[model samples]
Target: MFVFWLVQLISKAIYLYTVLLVIYALLSWFPGGYQSSFGRFLAKICEPYLGLFDHLNLSFGPVNFNIAFAIIVLQLASQALVLILNRIAFMF
Candidate 1:
């Protein structure tokens, strides 16, 4: 039961972070999006994670893939974690 709860919580967190990353990326579209308080708040949480993949030059011409890639990786990790947690839960 506890394991199920933990898995659900973690999965939600991962999904939320992915959404935040998308919002943060979209902020770049506005004239002063990143300069806003909300943008700053998002930067506090999203920048470091995005930084991990920044060097990959995920941009192609005008389209940037950094956020997309980060989200993909995060989702994959989340799925992997849930699988591991479910397996461990089954053992008990």
Candidate 2:
């Protein structure tokens, strides 16, 4: 029971973080948006995770493809974690 709740909490946190990442990516499109304090904070929180995909250098002529890929990956990971937690809870 406790484990289930804990997993739920963690899952929610991850989902929220993913949303923040999305916001960060969107803000990047505006000039000087990333220079704001809030933007910097978002970057600090999101960069490490997004940085993973950055290594792939997934880009076209101008678009940074990795940002989309990273967001998708984060969503998939959050879903998978929740699914696994539910499965474990069911087994117990």
Which candidate number would show the highest lDDT if scored against the true structure? 1
How much lDDT does each candidate structure score?
Answer: 0.94, 0.85
lDDT of 1 by residue, 1-92 (tens): 99999999999999899889999999999999999999999999999999999999988999999889999999999999999999999999
TM-score of 2: 0.87
**What residue pairs are clashing in model 1?**
none
List model 2 lDDT by residue over 1-92, tens digit each: 97689787988898798789889989978998899998999989988988898779988888887878988888788788888888888888
TM-score of each: 0.97, 0.87
The runs of at least 3 residues in candidate 1 whose Cα sits more than 4 Å from the true structure, single-residue gaps closed, are: none
RMSD of 2: 1.4
Query: Candidate 2: global Cα-lDDT?
Result: 0.85
Give the range where candidate 2 is weakest over 10 consecutive residues by summed lDDT: 2-11
Superposed by TM-score, candidate 1 places the C-alpha of residue 87 at a distance from the truth, in angstroms, of: 0.3
- In angstroms, the error of model 1 at 52 is 0.4
